[model samples]
Target chain A: MAFSTTIRQAYQDELAGLRTAGLFKEERYILGPQGADIEVEFPAGADGRPVINFCANNYLGLSSHPDVVAAARRGLETHGYGLSSVRFICGTQDIHRKLEKRLTEFLETEDTLLFPSCMDANAGCFEAILGEEDVMIADRLVHASIVDGMRLCKAMRDTYKHSDMGHLRDKLIEHQDKRIRMIITDGVFSMDGDLAKLDEIVALAEEYNAMVFLDDSHASGFIGKTGRGTHEHCGVMGKIDVITTTMGKGLGGASGGCVSGRRELVEMCRQRARPYLFSNTVAPMIVAGTLKVLDLVFASTERRDRLEANTSYWRRGLTEMGLDLKQGESPIVPVMLYNAKLAQDMARDLFAEGIYVVGFFFPVVPQGAARIRTQLSAAHTQAHLDKGLAAFRKVAGKYGILGKGKREIMEMYGK
Target chain B: MPIDKQMILDYVIREYLEEDDDTEITYNTELISGGIVDSFSMVSLKRFLEKKYNIQIPDADATPEAFDTVNSIAALVERFVKA
Candidate 1:
């Protein structure tokens, strides 16, 4: 069969349109491990340079920690590399079970089951439990993976306004006739750094007899006092029906995720969740590294404290410098620069100033709410924070993006 | 009760296009194609229509052409309301 010229032309046209619209995504090459300070290579064979990283989800800074690395090395030596099987097959090692147990204790849940990644964990959960008679109501700003997961499930889907408890209550009342009503939301919305009103959600769940589900991928390692996640922060521990989170973010920055909740629900996922039943097991190295992260997180509050301090200090410095920031207590802070072009331009200027951050615009956020979402890390010291703040002030000043001048900048962008 | 185009437009403006000027949206105004109503907004709009008019918008009618403009949305709602 001949190649379809029509298909090729269609793809070419789409790619050309993306390029013209400046919506084409380009990946920057990082030459070193993920950390607060790292060398990165821009496109076009640009030379590598060290910059303060503000885009990583390494909230606890355990990504490249010496002890975590050592644990991974030991994990490789003892448990080998790949499992080459799913959990139910020959892949249920003692470490995997141990890690799941540790996660249950850390999350303060009934049980936990691991997946290859949080994406898979989210994908697997909804379909495993929800049936056609059920209803899955979600926050509009929940992660894309959750949206896709709900799509795959047979439940009738409804979404309320983001972070609006009144809208959620309305949705719950509207869907009260369903056999089971499941309310889904992100613990911390990644883009805006806003948290779900879990306290109110739990209350509404009780009023409507609905189950509350939280995907705490962004909140897992540092939101609460001991880093137990949104449940702890919201003071609703043992109330949420299900909590899904990742090791990819705060928990050592490796690749794995889990669903921790009721024992029956977890057991059902273990047996029926497609991603869990079919995909390869979590690598022993990542599991070991994550186990170490749990140990460190449980042993001491130093990292969590440093992370909280850094977040508050950075937030205050940025606000005092007159940068427009979204309100939240999460380490994920979004400096709003409404114009998409300005967001891209400011991110580029900040990169030139040796501060690495990405611009989010258009489809990632709403059309008018473009921003540079900077995530704080425990690894970012006081000096790193100061340097980053200085760079931000300088670049923001160059673009005239200060407090009173923000309106002028928006008008200049014709937004 | 008959379907109300102005009511539909007002709800869309209030919920999805809160930042947009009220005069900007009219009966024939483009919604999805004009970038005002995204996929999430479409879901919300469908639910709103279902609740208000007691009409179930099948997935087949959830296309951009079928619901892109306020006029098209009003027409779709009218069809189910009359049926």
Candidate 2:
């Protein structure tokens, strides 16, 4: 037994197989700030122009805002770079309290608790709230973090098929006798860019005697009337039982997440959740920057309006180009490419024309449901969007995906 | 005895598989380890069994070893009936 086999190497071999299967995705480095236009490192090409970036989560374009940058500089000067301690210890700075209080006010919740990442927010929420005697009913297409969190919980859990109200009702009725039943879902599905049926979900929760938890990471900073997220989008503000969202995407594009709910629940999570209790406090720079983003969201709707306009323009142009578009009101616009190879090829070809997008296939999405997820930012100008649409149309034609493009797709479908 | 086995099979299939026609499930086979039934479904199944058969399934007994397949689940049910 001195030299026994270790299956650890087998896992890496499997990943190699995935790479050869045309599913291996690697990140490209960005040498500049996140904005509508971004510079991606690639070989020198014709124009040497930066690609029209459509993949960043910088929805508000606050990542490089002068105010946000100034706030970060001030935070560094006042509080330094890192805390080197967790919240309950010496990590609790006065600015952390100020950020939490401000977030509570912004989200209209009694209290808010921050986590290192929204993934942590989701992973820690389940175990902190429910136990073995309780039950959790979640949407099938909720974020991966929620699935992982539910796995950590000892509570009985079941997933209703994505957005199927009938299936959810049946499962809720089946477990109607459980002590605590929580219905959890994402406010907007990140992949399809479609919105959840929140109004319907809320009504169902009331009938099932279940509390609702919404992860609004994708919807928070630029959705709804005041950009208050799905609560505002659905006109159900103050109706949701729990709201969990991130500061990483639309909020400011730095890094942090929070669970906004009743005073007691947030307090309970503060005392128990592993990440909140153990992880280092979020840097004061991120706190101050996110607080500024929130101020912008509240002070004016110009940015949100611009984002909506840009989304509509891109969606309409792509649709007119005879591309398959995922139906939704969200800014995430998925261009369907049922074949994984085709999706990856399209993304590569689009890059040749100075447009950056991400191709998603199986494991991330279901088989025969591959897509190119294009995100629009408020930072983009109409001219930028028009240029992107032109590039997309050119790539689609090259891939044989439009008019005569339909013929090539048919040939592949027959194969 | 045959009626009890059929009942267990029906319950497992109905509880785990949502769309019966589209989804093809093989009964009396290793369900959990094969990834056909996940841990979440297993917990719900345990709750169903406790209510249906009046069997108190302890945390220790709720493992794939005890109830991996329909046959094993039926055996557990029979053992609970006798106990």
Q: RMSD of model 2, in Å?
A: 4.4
lDDT of 2 by residue, A1-415 (tens): 4433566577778899978877666657676788878778754333344788899898887878999888888888898898899989988788888888988887788899989999998998889988998888988778889989888988888877678888789988888889989998999999988888888888888898888899999999888977889888887787787899999999889999999988878988998888898788998888878878877888999998889988998999999989988889989999987777788889888888888998997767865567899998998998889889999888888777774343356467521
Worst 10 residues of 2 chain A by lDDT: A406-415
**How far in Å is the alpha carbon of A84 misplaced in model 1?**
1.1
Candidate 2: DockQ?
Answer: 0.23
Candidate 1 Cα deviation (angstroms), residue A16: 1.9
Interface Cα RMSD per model, in Å? 2.4, 3.8
Q: With candidate 2 superimposed using the best TM-score fit, by how many Å does residue A174's alpha carbon deviate from the native?
A: 1.4
As for candidate 2, its clashing pairs are A400-A405, A402-A405
Which residue pairs overlap in candidate 1's backbone?
none
* Candidate 2 off by > 4 Å: A1-12, A42-49, A403-415, B1-83
